[model samples]
Target: MATIFKTDAGNYKALVRKSGWPTTTKTFRTSRDAKDWARRIEDEMVRGVYIQRSGAERMTLEMALKRYLTEISPTKKPTTQRAEATKAQQLISHLGKYSMAALSAELIASYRDKRLASVTSRGKTTSNNTVRLELALLSHLFTVAIQEWGLGLSFNPVLNIRKPSAGQGRDRRLSAEEERCLLKAVNDHSNPMLGWIVRIALETGMRSSEITSLRRHQVDMKKRVARLSDTKNDSARTVPLSKWATETFEAALNNPIRPIDCDLVFFGEPGKDGKRRAYNFNKTWGVLKKKLGMADLRFHDLRHEAVSRLVEGGLSDQEVSAISGHKSMQMLKRYTHLRAEDLVGKLDMLTREH
Candidate 1:
């Protein structure tokens, strides 16, 4: 049964109640519109297809994203939380006005195309992986809204939309000559710690955050291992340190630039309130890359180089994965780029056996 009444604000409010269905309500400017909505809802209820979509219809994308940021993002890793927060902001800017119920597969596909064609402030086009990640965040939000938040969405719009192809993983390993030049440039840099950071990265296939956030207590110089309690995969891992890595930490310990306030292995200067923070060398890294004329190289590529070297040195996939902190074999394979020249000797041995 449905009931219609004129509100004090001169709008008609319709309320529908059924035995098994949740009570549904909607407000309309005219009595006819309210009655029409009630009839449609009643028909759907009788057909057993009625889903309470009032929450989705009433809540805009902006509101849902804001709620997700507050309620969900905080529970994620710091790096993931920061990245998702940025994605949420971008989503709010693009399609925030539409209510969740109004966001269809077509609308999501349109947003995807628009984002793919968009350029960043740095004058570079957005990568497919970046757009893919944004879409993933939106997909997760819809899933949460439907499952947990009682939004009553029949389907995730993002699921039906075509996502940008992530393409192949980067295989930008440093050449022997390029590596020498890069190391020389790093050594010439004003900050002595910068060179050691680069050296450690090449020696051990650790992510930038994992290397930077390393605590003094986590490193066991005698054992030549660094135990990370918090990794991107939320799994604690112990990475074996190379002789060069151990030496670099030893030098950093004696360096005056290393802060005293924090136990951070690579600590930065004190802030306005005298609180030490993690060392940030992004600017210096950029300058060094430009000076070396390797603008295409990323700091992360050093990890790729390390992984490739490990594979070339005949380390098993399992051994390399343990050192690199890669949780999945598929992910570890992406980082491993073997050189054709390095395979020639193995190919020759096979010929001899034949």
Candidate 2:
């Protein structure tokens, strides 16, 4: 049974009390609205399909995001934590005021459309990949709320909305001239760490973060291997060091200027917390690239170049994946952009042998 009462503010309040269900109440603007809500609750109770939605109605998106950042973000990698925090701010700016119960698929779809059409502070149009990552974070938040926090969401609205397409992977390959210029610039820089880092990336397909965050003990010069326990995909891998990579690592590890207190291979200046973190050469990298007239070249392209060279050197896919730490063959293929000029030499050798 349900009861409708008139509030002092001229609104109608509906309260439902069933034999086997918890008491629920809601306020509506009109008596008709209250009556309709009360009837629905009672019918659901009778059908044993009633869910207590008061928690969802009271909690706003901003509140949920705050909780998620505090509790969930810390469990992720440092790079992921920073990225998610940025994405959370964007989501909060647009839809934070809405309660979880009020977020419908249509509303989320509108957000998606608006984000797709928006521009960033850099005056560039937002990429589909960026929007997709933001939506993925939101979807995961909703899932966590329902499954872990016991929020009374019937279904994830984000799941019902269409995700933006994952845009094409970058196929930028470093040319021989560009590589020569880049190496000369890095080697001539005041810091030799930058040069060693660049050489290691070219010789081994290691990510910038992975290269910068390496500790002395993780590298074994005798075994010619670098053990990576903290990777992007949460999988541990041991990377075989090429002769060039091994020499670079040896130079970097034996750096006379290295601080005794710092365990990082590429140590930055002490932060405000008085702790040395991974080397942050983003600004330096940007300046160097602009100076060399290769302003569009990205550091990650060095890894791509290395991966492509490995394939061209006649390493099998399985062998390359082991060294590159790529879990998927498809993703590994994306990193390989073979140059026709380089392949011509191999073709001539094959013809001579035949």
- 1-354 in candidate 1: lDDT tens per residue? 999999999999999999988898999999999999999999999999988888899999999999999999999988898999999888999999999999999988988899999999999988899899999999999999999999889999898978888799999989889999999988887878788789989999888888888888888888989899878888889988888889997887677766556688887778899888778999889977988889999999999999989989989988998888887899988999899988999999999999
Indicate which candidate wins on lDDT: 2
Kindly list the per-residue Cα lDDT of model 2 for residues 1-354, writing each as its tens digit: 899999999999999999989999999999999999999999999899988999999999999999999999999888899999999999999999999999999999999999999999999989999999999999999999899887788889999988998878888898789889899999999999999999999999999988998999999999999999888888899999999999999999999989998888999998899989989999999999999998888999999999999999999999999999899999999899888888898899999999
Q: What is the C-alpha RMSD of each candidate to the true structure, in Å?
A: 2.0, 1.7
Model 2, TM vs. native: 0.95
Poorest lDDT segment (10 consecutive residues) of candidate 1: 253-262
Candidate 2 deviant stretches above 4 angstroms: 345-354
On a 0 to 100 scale, what is the lDDT of residue 245 in model 2?
A: 90
User: Using TM-score as the measure, which candidate wins?
Assistant: 2
